[model samples]
Target: MADSQRTSEPTNFVHQDEIWKAHVKVEKDLAKVWPNKWGFLTETYKEYERESLKLKEEARMKLPHHLAARPPTPPEKNIHVSRSPSVPQTTQAFIGWRSAHSHLQLEKYGTVHHGRRSFLKELGWPLDACS
Candidate 1:
């Protein structure tokens, strides 16, 4: 019984009108600050046009025609987790190659001269993972 009765909420009559006026005022201020030159107006930028066109076209082409997507197959459970002796040796070799004193460090093997990616890839790591 106590919650049965309710009163109407008070409203501001000029609230919405004031908001529109503020927006118009801001727009006019912006126009004065960054106005068109010689009556020519441009809302968009130029460099972004060329840069975005390729990405936009690629995105447009990638859209699938069908709505249903095929679910991925479950992974195998009994995957082997073995490594060869040479793999560890290669990994240690790779680590030694990147250090400041790498030349002195791996001097036991004469010289460990190799590219950063190639040295790591020789140890069973993917070549493209770094990039």
Candidate 2:
């Protein structure tokens, strides 16, 4: 039966030489359809790069001389102070001294800052506690 013949087909029928010849044939067919494919792509990319460079040069030339020469100024720093009716000055000064580690008391706080970690645990570095 045809079903029996299909079931008994040899598994090792494919040869490396036949596969290589088929590959060569496919490449030849592609070459006939599109000759110098890689060369055409390279030329198109080069043309695009050339046009981009030309446009950049033209844009640079159009900018005003003073705008191009001078650098932008940095933003001004503003300090804010708040006055409260009930809170004593000494209490606020003590809190500032504790946070800054400085002897002089600060009236207006700029930013609450943290010091660098002295131990591995503070910096989140892993340590073997069992050993």
Which prediction has the highest lDDT against the true structure?
2
Model 1, range 12-58, lDDT digits (tens) per residue? 76996899899999999887877555233343555567669989998
Q: Name the regions of candidate 1 deviating beyond 4 angstroms.
A: 1-7, 36-131
lDDT of all predictions: 0.62, 0.68
Q: Give per-residue CA lDDT, model 2, range 10-38, as digits (tens).
A: 75546867888899999999988674555
Best by TM-score: 2
Which 10-residue window in model 1 sums to the lowest lDDT?
Answer: 80-89
For model 1, what is the alpha-carbon lDDT of residue 128? Answer: 77
- In model 2, residue pairs whose N, Cα or C atoms come closer than 3 Å (at least 3 residues apart or on different chains), thus clashing, are none
What 10-residue stretch in candidate 2 is worst by lDDT? Answer: 79-88
